[model samples]
Target: MSSQSSTQGAALAPEKRETFSSRKLFILSAIGSAVGLGNIWRFPYVAYENGGGAFLIPYIVAIFCAGIPLLFLDYAIGHRYRGSAPLSYRRANRKTEIIGWWQVLICFVIAIYYAAIIAWAAMYCWYSVTKAWGNDAEGFFYGEFLNTADTVGVSFDFVPNVFFPMLIVWIFTIVIMVAGVNKGIARANAVFMPLLIVMFLILVVQSVFLPGAIDGLNAFFTPNFDALQNPAVWAAAFGHIFFSLSVAFGIMVTYSSYMKRKSDLTGSGYVVALANSSFEILAGIGVFAALGFMAYNANSSVDSVVSGGIGLAFIAFPTIVSAAPFGALIGVLFFGSLVFAGLTSLISILEVIVAAFQDKLGWGRVKATLIVSIPVAVVSLLLFSATTGIYLLDTIDAFVNQFGILACALVMVIVFGSGLGMLPKLAKHLNRHSSIKLGTGWMVLVGGIGPAVLAYMLINEFQAKITEQYSGYPAWFNGVFGWGLCGLLIVVAGLISLIPWSKNSKLEDPEYDQHQQNVQAEAVPETVSKEY
Candidate 1:
């Protein structure tokens, strides 16, 4: 066989291949990573908070205009380079790889807190089966999960049960990575994703049957033009689209690096977007419908029944589930689906860290996975500590998800969208075989409008912090903790950027001859040669 065909065929062999993800498997795994608890638990609340049904306007627009283009960009970059985010970014543009590292850094922070949240979901799943959460759903959660007193005073508690489950989660993640992609991640997604969809459909059906469901549905779908007119609402909608789709982060880049050359990224991009948005719509229907029922029964506004943070899941969801027929069964299924979703995403995030370790430190995949898992596991153990531990998790989650991600995303836009002269090259590659070709229009969006909006969001986010510090918190606690944490993260990221290793890095420019040779080798027709 020709050298190129030989490599392609070798990739199919289980024993010889280093990374064994197929085009089919890549798509499935990508879908699994993208569709998660965020779609079910978070999106509903965000949709409700923003503009209700009116949110869909900006949301749909963002998907096409922003989300899909970025998704394809990551895929094209990754598949072409056949490396993880750090390597892909460096391979694309050596100097610009620093920006990619920033994205990787964000994923690392997210993995710490994200795993904790997943642990919470696993705990809920266990409780569902054990019936530990009795009919007094809200009380059980607040008393057991959210309220504990220790040195930190009244705060959340990290039970041993929660921590142990997280260990299982970490183990599960490593095993999937060890399985070499196709057999592990792909097979897992093939099984779990369908189950997620089925459960969602069943919940939607059940929710619609609940009395006052229409009121919730109407509230969710009905556009509030007033809210739509607000620029902040539009920004929120766009940001949610970006965050929920898992763009800006290097996860998509890493995942796509495993794709076969012939993979139709534009087609797969559409599939991922459709599947993701459908989950959001389904989640909105499920959540608001349940809220509508709750409102009708309680004779109050839906807002009264709503709560934020983990309370929404641990408290509000369980309360809603208890009122339904076969409550325990449904609760089990819902939380089970959540565990699956979170696990899938967690695996992708951890893979980014593992890949970086392997590329930078020259460690083998197994060694890298184990090495990364150890420190993460050790830190994650803190989440099991008494009251103080839970507070740390909350603070970490907010700081990382809100600030770190936004910061990394802005840097990525600046680097990929502006710093490196890859926009024209990217547009050309994206347009080459793409059914929906992205062009100069996308360049303007990513380089100009996208960055401006991301900057505005970051500023607003920090301003919100300031407002909360001065006016929202108690005098003693004001500005002390929150600002300190934010400042620390900033310092850490800045120090990372200054490291000598990043200063002289050389990234392979995608438009260069070497890159073209690599792409041509991979994309060559199967019938062209079989002689090696």
Candidate 2:
């Protein structure tokens, strides 16, 4: 508020915005973003449905051929250009600026609902102490806890149980966002990432000692090689790897934009990729082990109790905790891990939007953080804190992730592959920055193989959607909420791009210019001539 402070803030240079203090911080922050609730709740069921242990084959293949390659692309662009996704894309191809906005908006939409889920984790963290969901976890989650009304539309009917904790979740996220990149986001990941792993290890160690531990591990790892022949199973494998690695969203681009010039971009990508998948395997072991105990108690097989998404985390896991020895302590640790994982991911989502504002409008970090965080917090508190919150979250999440994020990723792959002919140049840029240099194999995977898989995913989803409603939800629900929002996101992104870019914006840093010069000189195709 003082004149000197005001002058300093207004005069802040673009280079002074923020960066990860160390390579360790960068890797951990990215891993935290990728290893969200989905890796734990969704991957186990995806594996179970797609041939259990045999699913690892497709999952690993998808990672090497699709996930890690796209990750390198994101890292190369962000680190080379030192801008948010939109700015970075504009730098790649001025015409593809809208693609960057599209991805950034998708991150914004995801952040809104994602914060609400973290709030649920936060509340469950407290509820664990007394087994507050009581003996019937499912009923408590739908009835007493969420008080979820049986409706497809939004309502003003608020649920105090969900509202208060969600408020705290938003508040905590805002404080961290306001703390700036190194001091807040990176530092928070440095702490929570370790705690999350330690707590999960405790749960897994305790779980294997349970009476049905072997049964659970068998259910998870038991291979069904025949399932690999099914295209749907292979599709599931690609989808899981796509969402799990956080490539489609702008989170990786935004996070990597903060890395120092000499950092190893490709090496860091591999590190984050392995760390994320490693956590998924660890979660499978702990989650299935606990579910094994639940099935044992009910005189059922692991197959009988197996479910995914909210059911696995809120219902199945809680049921296991209540029946296990030392239920309360285990419950606290489990839900606490969810809170940490979800919180770290939520910060990354918010940073994507904040970075966009800072890069385009030349706003300072605090101003950008407050501008974006305040309204989003209000929306989360109001939009997803009602009796119908659970249903609304389900519809929106399915719609946004499938159509919004996946579609953007496909566009990016095409733009880099053939449209702009920049995939070769981007790979060259990556090799320039990384010690472990990539070759033509990286280009083929990202430009050709990756796009082919993504196109198949989009087409597969379209074919299924045309024939039947997703999840057996009402046709009207799928139409209005699912497809309608996907279309709207594109329109909104176009409108966002129409906003006047900051004239005073400076992308003329010597290092930024030098990186571009070297990339163009190395292997840029003759067909690609545009320069940002």
Candidate 3:
């Protein structure tokens, strides 16, 4: 075979020539990606809004029912194929590769907006150091940062002041991606994730010591059954599970594709989920406790303590920090931790697209990293320039978090739950050494109940948004148009699947199988695959 044909043949194989990442590195990278700014900033605000402490029930339920099972599904698919999103799904089932590719595309869009948000966090961290948030910090932040074009009549401008910090974020993300899985992403996570945990623990400890910290903790942990009546609560819980676990974006798949054959999928999945949930719980205790203290100090209601989007981190958090004892030092640590978490997740998202470029386009990994980084950096610079950039960011955040991710995840559940028969096989692969196996219960969750709940949430959310027209929504915010646009994008992506591979060979073509066997024989030792 010619070199080009050989490369195409390997791509068509179910198994390809690739090195397995160390299990330790795999766990660290996955955990790093999961424990992001969402766990710290978004989760607390969302939990407070939905039910304060009440949202935990559905959130935890969603984790086991959907999060854990889907994680295993992604891991199984990636490890089996040893390829990135599109190729992994193509190997598993050719027809569903379109669904997988759509997931990757969503990740790309998310990465663009996500880079902008990361830049915001980095800017906040820098401001904290510069002491730019002077007296009346909250007022200044509300006026200068949170207020939108509609609210303040200021048009967005992409100036050098904002673009420079964004450039830093992009550069940092690229450096991690260029290093590949082990030495770069995994190692950085191992170091930074632990530091984040330590900082959060410190904050939690300090928060519990506050005057009303116990009361705050009580309110957050106590169950409020009334929250169950609101469909928004269920929707928020479901969305959090999907976003927190980093599912449906091809991120988990890309990360897992680097895992060693002998890596423990069940163990890794459980650990990632547990670690992520623990961070949420800890963040809630810290945030609500501080908020409780703040409310007492300001003579405000608990509801007054709640904030969302960038305001939670920049405005609300700064207010809380300023009131705390030794507030400046604490603020620095907290925001610094947030920056670390955001950057870690940012790296993973960027890596997914970079990996796709390298695997499909045959670009060198380093070269692909730089190529993807440039556009991401430029777009993020534009996004940050919106005088209403914060508002625009919030909209994109909701669209991606609430709609895009849910849409992608729904497709994933349908594809794996129905199109692919790999769930049971995956459970067996994951549970090979474990005493506990995800049995019929998991199958029911992934295949039937999970998708049903997702569909219900989507429909109910759409209806609710339609009924509630806020003054702030743009003229273009028509519900039917938005849903149709999303649907069209997904369908267009699926149509791309029908196009034949330029190489004109099926995955099961004999030549491809032979190439895989040859590559496997030469690269991976039999003992490695057999080893635990």
RMSD of candidates 1 onward, in order: 5.4, 4.4, 4.9
Best by TM-score: 2
lDDT-superior candidate, 1 or 3? 3
The TM-scores of all predictions, comma-separated, are 0.86, 0.93, 0.86
**lDDT tens per residue, model 1, 1-532:** 5999999987753322134356566777788888876787888888878888888888888887777777777877776666777678767766665666666666776777677677777778767766677778767764676454444422335566566777777778778877656776778887888887887677778887888888888877877878877888877887788888888778898887766544667778888888889888988888788778877777887878865557678887787676766666667767877877888888788777777656655566677778887787666666444455555555555666777677777877787777775767766655555566566787888788778878998998878766654433343443333455555655664555445442212233323345457665775556333211
Question: Per-residue alpha-carbon lDDT of model 2 for 237-306, expressed as tens digits?
Answer: 9899999988968888888889986688888999999999999999999989888888898989999999
Worst 10 residues of 2 by lDDT: 523-532
Candidate 3 lDDT tens digits, 1-532: 5999999977865433344357667777888888888888788888877776678888888888778877777776776666778777887777777766687666666677777666666667667655566766676665555344445222556544456667777787788788877778888888888898898888888877877776666666777789889877887787788779887778888887787555677787898888889888888888888777777778776677767556677777677776777666667777878878888888888777777656655566788788877887776667655665665555555555567667677777887878676667666656554435567777788889778877887776566556754236653643323444466657767765665554422344343356457655665544233221
The clash count of every prediction, one per candidate, is 6, 0, 2
For each candidate, the alpha-carbon lDDT, in order, equals 0.71, 0.85, 0.71
Error of 2 at 304 (Å): 0.4
Ordered list by lDDT, greatest first: 2, 3, 1
Clashing pairs in 1: 1-530, 1-531, 1-532, 2-530, 2-531, 94-507
